[model samples]
Target: MIVFFHHLTLATTTTNPSYLTPSTARCNSTAVTSCTTTTSIIARCQSYEVSWNNHCYYLDGLGGNCTTGYSLATNAVLGCIATQFASKTYRSTISNNCCVWTADTYECYGFNNNCNTAGPFSAGPVWSGAGCLSVQQRYSAQLTFCGSN
Candidate 1:
């Protein structure tokens, strides 16, 4: 199992209102093709993968120019992980903090203050695909975040 531990610099103006909130879903995957049965299960597995990939992308500052900065964050993180580990299992431990600017136009970044705050958090280990012959390997992905108190 591969492991990654680091802090993400996520800062934006108040007008942007960016929060370091975790994804609602614990696990996500992509759609599976060429499957005749157990489509639902396959879909779930795919969703988990997709969810984790997106999370990685956003954290790496590749989420693109979105109002909430979600898109950029997801893309960056995903791209970084994929580039390094083409085909390998890895776990990530993320340090979560809410940083925001004082004004909409001005940039003043800080964490866990009146201007910035934290949100609900959750983390778990992700198992490789199940019931899908295409992905019959034992891999695990664990993600944890340090919430701002």
Candidate 2:
């Protein structure tokens, strides 16, 4: 038999933009599990954490089927992360933007501006070139909410 363990440590410090406010900081820890057998395997992955001001957020996994779109998956993962990290909140104030992949065009598109301010319904860009021709490619965009400046 084989055993596997995973641990994640998140740490952050905030710098006050003005003299009237004081700096703040925090740190968090969580464990993820993965196991494998000769016939099958189970794994759990975590998205790269995003931090703004003093808050941190991450998607636990894809969370749902991406074939429809990322909105559902994004919302579900954010909710789960919020519940796990009680002290921090998902950046709901942030705009809902996703890097969508078009199978036919074989391109990955991002928001025109900051991911947070981009409108929710924007379809994004379409580009075609050498690296953009792979229909088997995959990409993802992650959004998180935090305190404003």
Candidate 3:
């Protein structure tokens, strides 16, 4: 039987990035490498996790979707913009932290401390990239809230 493989990396502009999954079936403890199947990759991602840029990310704050995670989430200090993560859910286990944007990188950076605001929603998992980063590194790289649909 010929088994077709699904490539997880979807072609997307930074302005509208799509959720990615493991491209390979067998992945090392570090990166996804050559493999002959795809089931392993799919299993790698958790229920609350989504794959992107060849790695697993937790579902955090979301942009666009015509809805906000919390009341003050739209504040300028949060740097919530209708950019890459717009219309899509941002992955993180942290709180009202900003998704720091650099020249070529945009990772959710903050702590587990919730913002001084209140709403029907709550912060998502306090993840550190689901094995993507060390626990100690989580201090600089935090997660986002899991907003409602």
Best by TM-score: 3
Residues 1-149, candidate 2, lDDT per residue (tens digit)?
99988898989997632311211211112312121122333223223333322333332212122222122212212222322332222223332333323212222222343333422323222222122222323333333221112
What is the number of residue pairs that collide in model 1? Answer: 28
Candidate 2 regions exceeding 4 Å error are: 1-64, 67-99, 116-149
Best of the two (1, 3) by TM-score: 3
> lDDT at 90 for candidate 1?
17
lDDT of 1 by residue, 1-149 (tens): 99999989988764511232222322223521121221233212221133332232211111112223223222112222222222222122222222211112211222222111122222211122112112211112112111111
Measured on C-alpha atoms, candidate 1 has an lDDT of: 0.22
Candidate order, lDDT descending: 3, 2, 1
lDDT of 3: 0.29
TM-score of each: 0.17, 0.19, 0.21
Worst 10 residues of 3 by lDDT: 70-79
lDDT of 3 by residue, 46-110 (tens): 44443332333333432211123221121111222212232233443323333322111233223
lDDT, model 3, position 61: 34
